[model samples]
Structure formats: structure tokens, C-alpha cells
Target: MSDEARVVRIVPNGPVMVQGPVRIEMPDGTVVESDRFMCAICTCRRSKIYPLCDTSHRRRQRAKDDESSTTVTVQAPAEA
Candidate 1:
């Protein structure tokens, strides 16, 4: 380990950023490494690339609000 400090930042509703180069050991006994200046680790588990952020956690646009509007009707049971 180097004397330099490693910084980790947790982004709200997003991935966790880490200062690389880093070596990560997966649950399957496999090790993954990255030598990039920074690394984005997925927290939402929605990334197509596990342990990496592909911006898959971003909110997607749903059908137009007006077109996708839903109306619910509740009916009372008949009196005994």
C-alpha cells in the first residue's frame, strides 16, 4: 500500500467513486483490478457490468406523464 491516502466518495443515488488503482475481490474468488485514475463502483446493482458503473442507475424517462396517467376507482361493497 502506498503512503498516499485513497479517497472514496459515495454519491447520492449513484455509484461509489474510488481513487484507483484498485484491486477488488469478488464473491466467487475472482479478482478484478483497475489502474485508472478513478473508478466507479455500482451500488444499485443495475449495471450491466457488475462492480462498475455504466450510468445504469440514472432515472429513465417513462411514457409521457399525460399518456401514462392511471385512474383508479374503488367501489363500496353492497350493504348487508
Candidate 2:
């Protein structure tokens, strides 16, 4: 558990991917394991992984698509 190393990278349209040894401290004073051999941090904030990314964004994206089906009502601009 020594050899502590941290890797932080930003993934497009997704969460960050962290590699190497990492320690994530929760507000509850609980330190979660951020390295599952490698960690994929959620940037979309929609990851079911909680503190990691399990590719759950796919489902989130699908839900987003479904939401897009609803038409957005825009009010006309007031006459200047």
C-alpha cells in the first residue's frame, strides 16, 4: 500500500480516469479505494459508480435522449 502514486486525467463527455495508487477521502471521514487497479472518476456526476465510473453514463445518455423528446417551450421576445 506504500508506493503511492496519483494519476488524474479528464475524459471527454465522461468522468476522469485516475491510475496508480490513490486515496479518496469522503466527507464522512471514510477513505474509499480510488484505485481498482485503476480508477475512473465520474465527471458527469451521473455515474452509478458513486466515486468511480462503471460506464453507467451510457444509461444516463439514453435518459438524456428520452428527455430530448419533450419539446421545449420558448416564450416570444418582448417587442423593443
Candidate 3:
């Protein structure tokens, strides 16, 4: 623990996990520190908490499986 090494992990389609103490400086010079052993940093920019990951990256569940898999490629109308 004396070494104080910090580790970061990029979760697939998810947050960036940071281990150990970390200080995050915002755009306006506001500093946020993590008290937990690990913290999730938002990557999708959808978090209400800005830099923190509130699991906003998760995809919404479709009612039907076909609805989830369907990809509708729309064609533009021909110019008159």
C-alpha cells in the first residue's frame, strides 16, 4: 500500500474503472476525490453525475427480440 500505485480498467461499452485514490479536476477547476477503492468514470457522456458513471451507458431493453435486432435502412425519396 506504500507504493500507492493506481490502476485503471476500461470496461467494454461501459465506464473506466479506477482503483486507489484519485482526484478528478473538472473543466471549471472543481476537484472531486474518490473515497471508494474503485470508481466508475463515465464514457458515454449520459451520466447525470457528469464524470461519474451512473450506468447510463447500458442499452434500453426492447420489448421484443426482433425489435432489438431490426435495422431499418431508410432510402431517400428520388428527386423530382
- Measured by lDDT, the strongest candidate is 1
Off by over 4 Å in 2: 1-6, 59-80
Candidates sorted by TM-score, descending order?
Answer: 1, 3, 2
lDDT of 3: 0.66
lDDT of 1 by residue, 1-80 (tens): 68987899999999899987667777665566666687778899987566776677888733455322222122343346
Off by over 4 Å in 3: 1-4, 60-80
Q: What is the model-wide C-alpha lDDT for candidate 2? A: 0.56
Report lDDT (CA) for all predictions: 0.68, 0.56, 0.66
Give the lowest summed-lDDT range of ten residues in model 2: 67-76
RMSD of 3: 16.1
Ordered list by lDDT, greatest first: 1, 3, 2
lDDT at 14, model 1: 91
Candidate with more favorable, higher TM-score: 1 or 2: 1
Clashes of each: 0, 1, 0
